[model samples]
Target chain A: DAGVTQSPTHLIKTRGQQVTLRCSPKSGHDTVSWYQQALGQGPQFIFQYYEEEERQRGNFPDRFSGHQFPNYSSELNVNALLLGDSALYLCASSFASQPGNEKLFFGSGTQLSVL
Target chain B: AQTVTQSQPEMSVQEAETVTLSCTYDTSESDYYLFWYKQPPSRQMILVIRQEAYKQQNATENRFSVNFQKAAKSFSLKISDSQLGDAAMYFCAYKGRYGNKLVFGAGTILRVKS
Candidate 1:
């Protein structure tokens, strides 16, 4: 079975510009979550999407937003990007029924560079 | 609020030897979950192991095992017979019973020397 897949392996954008990264959830998974990993640091949760709505969100600012399609694919959008926004954006997928018991399958991640 | 902490920023071990990564968390919830995720150079976050708060028995996966101390709020990962493939950044993560988001530690970099 296919695991999680993310598009735009790498991209560069300037400050104040917006970028959208895409993710295809793993086979048989319904929930999708996005995370931002700074250089040499662990990933910080951005938000989670279930049933086409955001179920939970982290401490990120409003500039960060996400969307989940009916097929369980997701897209993370960052507006007015800043230098700090340059990081690896990872996408993880899991089943909602299992909740905390289910292991998250992650994609290789899209590397975003903000100038 | 839930927080995870990894004390060791970096650790090294000889091949075939064992290495332990330390982690501690703070959470008021009686039921929660803990996880150890390994990110190699490829940048894919792989789940190494997981532990449920209510389970008294420790969680183990192949060569990876966790020492879970719920009272002390400590969770440590022990890798046995370490190999070069095990070299990566290991992150400790926590999630409360009612929430779906995961709080992660700063991570500990492990290097296996042959």
Candidate 2:
């Protein structure tokens, strides 16, 4: 089975520019979540999408937003990016039906570099 | 709000030896899940082992085991007979009973010396 896949393994943009990272969740999974991993740091939750609607969000600013298509693919958009936005964006997917035992499968992540 | 912390920034162990990575979390919820994820240089977060808060017995997967102390809100990963492939950044994550969002620690880099 194909695992969670993210596009544009690496991206570079200047400050104030906008960036959109894409993610295709693992087969048989419906829920998609986004995370940010700064250098030498662990992944931090950004937001989660279930049933095509945002279910939960972290403490991120409004510049960070995401969408989940009917096919279970997701896109993370960052507007007015700052240099601090330069980090690895990880996409994780799980089954929404499984509440307590939900296991997340992560993608290789898109490395965004803001200049 | 929930938070996870990994006190150790880095740890080293000789080949075939064992090492333990420490983690502590704070959560008001009575039920939650703890996970240890391994991220290699390739950068994919892979689940190493997981422990549910309600389970008193420590969760073990092959050579990977977790010491889950519910009262202390501490969860530590112990890797036995470590291998070269085990050299990676290990992260401790938390998920409450109602949500899927994970709270992660700063991560601990494990180095295996041959």
Candidate 3:
């Protein structure tokens, strides 16, 4: 079975520009979550999507948004990117939205560089 | 909000030796889960081990085990017979029983010397 997969292994964008990163959830998984890992820091939750709707979101601002397609794939969009946005964007997929069953399978993250 | 903390930013151990990475968390919820994830140089986050709050017995996976102290809110990972391949950034993560959201610690960089 395939694990989670993310596109655009690396990217570079200037401040105020936008970027969209894609993710394909693991097979048999229906929930997708996005995380941002800055240099020297742990991954921080961005948001989660289930059944094509956002189920939970972290402390991130409105500039960060995401969508889940019917097939359980996801896309994370960061608008008006700041230099601070430069980080590794990770995508994790789980079988369900429940807590105990939410063992996440993460993809090799997309490295975003904002100038 | 629940918070996880890893006191040690870096740790080192000789090959074939044992090393323990420490973690502590704060949460008002009675039920939750703790996880240890390893991110290698390739940057893929892999789950090392996990423990449910209700389970008193420590969770073990092969050479990796966790010392879960419910009262102290501590979860430490012990890697035995470490190898050079064990070197990676280990992160401690927590999630409450009600939601799937995870709060992670700053991460501990482990170096296994050959």
Candidate 4:
């Protein structure tokens, strides 16, 4: 059983540039949620995708967007990035229709550094 | 809005000893879930333990146990017989009954001294 997987272990982008991160949900899971973890800080929720639609979003600005494919994989896109965007982008997968006891499975995360 | 807070920025414990990490969350929903995730140097967010608000009994997993105080919105994690592998950043997270997103705390770093 493969767990959640994310692409681009690390990335570097300049201010005003855009970056895209990818995630493959864990097997048997259909919901994918994105998070940002600043240095030395816990991860903050970005958004969650279910049934190819965003079901919940955090306080993030409109510059951040996401997409969930029919296969349950997801992508996080950040546009007009700033230095504050330098953080670890994490992807977690869970079964949205399951009971609340079903825990989330997270990927190793992509380390993004904005110049 | 749900939020989590970890008061201890850093904590240390001798190997084979025990260590406790404190966490408190704010939420209005009576049905929800609380979790403690460990992020090691590898950067993988690993689920350590979890508690359901409906269950009054605290949750425990192997050497990891949680003191879940739903009335007080407190969820403290206790690691028994700590080992070097237990050294990592511990995070407290919460999710509402209808939401899939997790709100996390600032995290507490744990160092195991051999």
Candidate 5:
């Protein structure tokens, strides 16, 4: 079965520009979560989407938003990006039914370079 | 809020030897889950092992195992007979019983020298 897949493995943007990252959930999974991993740091939660709605979000600012399609694919949009936004954006997928027990399947992640 | 910490920034081990990575977490919830994820140079985060709070028995997967001390809020991963492929950044993660988000540690880089 196919695992989680993300688009544009790498991206480059300017401080005032916006970028969109796409993710396709693993087969048989519905819940999608986005994370940002800065250089040499662990990933920080961005937000989570289930049933086409954002169920929870992290401490990120409003500039970060996401959308989950009915098919379980998701997109992360960052507006007015800053240099600090230069990081690896990881997308993970898991089944919402077994939230606590299911293991999150992660994509290779898109490396965002903000100048 | 839940937080995970990995104090070791980097660790090295000879091939075929063993290495342990330490992790500690802070959480108010009684029931939660802990995980160890390995991110190689390819940047894909792969689950190494996991432990459920209520379970007394430690969790083990192949050559990887976890020492979970719920009372002390400590979780450590031990990799046996380390191989070159094991060289990567190992991250400690935590998840609450009610929430779906995972809190992660800064990560420890493991280097296996042949």
Candidate 6:
């Protein structure tokens, strides 16, 4: 079974530039969530998408937004990025809505560097 | 709001020895889940083990086990008979009963000396 997959394993952009990171959830999974992991830090929840609608969001600002396609793939978009936006963008997927199923299989993550 | 904390930034243990990584969380909800995820240099977040808050007997998976004190809001991971492959960054995560979003701690890096 293919696990969660993310695109553009690494990215570099200048301040004020916009970036969109993609994710394909694991087979048999329908929920997709995005996280940000700064260097030497743990992953922080950005938001979660279920049934093609955003279900929950974290403390992130409006500059961070995401979408889930009908096929269960997800895209995280950051507008007018700041240097602090530079971090590893992680994508995680779960099989169901069950609380126990949310251990979440994570992707290798897209490392975004804002210079 | 929920939060998870890992007090230790780094730890080391000799090969074949054992070590424990500590974690604590803050949540008002009565039911939730705790997880230990291992991220090696390859950067894949692999699930090491998990514990459900309602289970009082604790959760054990092979050499990896957790001490879950729900009343105290503390969950700790103990890895027995560690190996070189166990050298990695370990993270503790939390999720409330209703949603799928996870709250993660700062993470602890484990070094295994041969």
Residue-pair clashes per candidate: 0, 0, 0, 0, 0, 0
lDDT of 1 by residue, B1-114 (tens): 888999999999999999999999999999999999999989999999999999999999999999999999999999999999999999999988768888899999999999
Tens digits of per-residue lDDT for model 5, B1-101: 78899999999999999999999999999999999999999999999998999999999999999999999999999999999999999999999977889
Scanning candidate 2 chain A in windows of ten residues, the lowest lDDT window is A94-103
List each candidate's DockQ score: 0.78, 0.88, 0.79, 0.80, 0.87, 0.75
Residue B67 lDDT in candidate 5: 96
Local error of candidate 4 at A43, Å? Answer: 0.6
Candidate 5 residue runs with Cα over 4 Å from true position: none
Candidate 3, B1-114: lDDT as tens digits: 889999999999999999999999999999888999999999999999999999999999999999999999999999999999999999999998778688999999999998
> Order the candidates by DockQ, highest first — what do you get?
2, 5, 4, 3, 1, 6
Report the poorest 10 consecutive residues by lDDT, candidate 2 chain B.
Answer: B94-103
Mark the 10 consecutive residues where model 6 chain B has the least summed lDDT: B95-104
Off by over 4 Å in 2: none
Where in model 4 is the C-alpha error above 4 Å?
none
Interface RMSD measured for model 3: 1.2
TM-score of every candidate = 0.98, 0.98, 0.98, 0.97, 0.99, 0.97
Worst 10 residues of 1 chain B by lDDT: B94-103
Name the TM-score of candidate 5: 0.99
Span of 10 residues, lowest total lDDT, candidate 3 chain B: B95-104
Residue clash pairs of candidate 4: none
Residue ranges of candidate 6 with Cα displaced over 4 Å: none
Per-candidate Cα RMSD to the true structure, in Å, reads 0.8, 0.7, 0.9, 1.1, 0.7, 1.1
Query: What's the C-alpha lDDT at position A44 in model 4?
Result: 91
Q: Which 10-residue window in model 1 chain A sums to the lowest lDDT? A: A96-105
- Candidate 6: give the clashing pairs: none
* DockQ class, candidate 2: high
- Cα lDDT tens digits, model 2, B44-111, are 99999989888899999999999999999999999999999999999999999887689999999999
Report the TM-score of the second chain of model 5 against its true counterpart.
0.99
Candidate 1 Cα errors over 4 Å, as ranges: none
Candidate 3: DockQ? Answer: 0.79
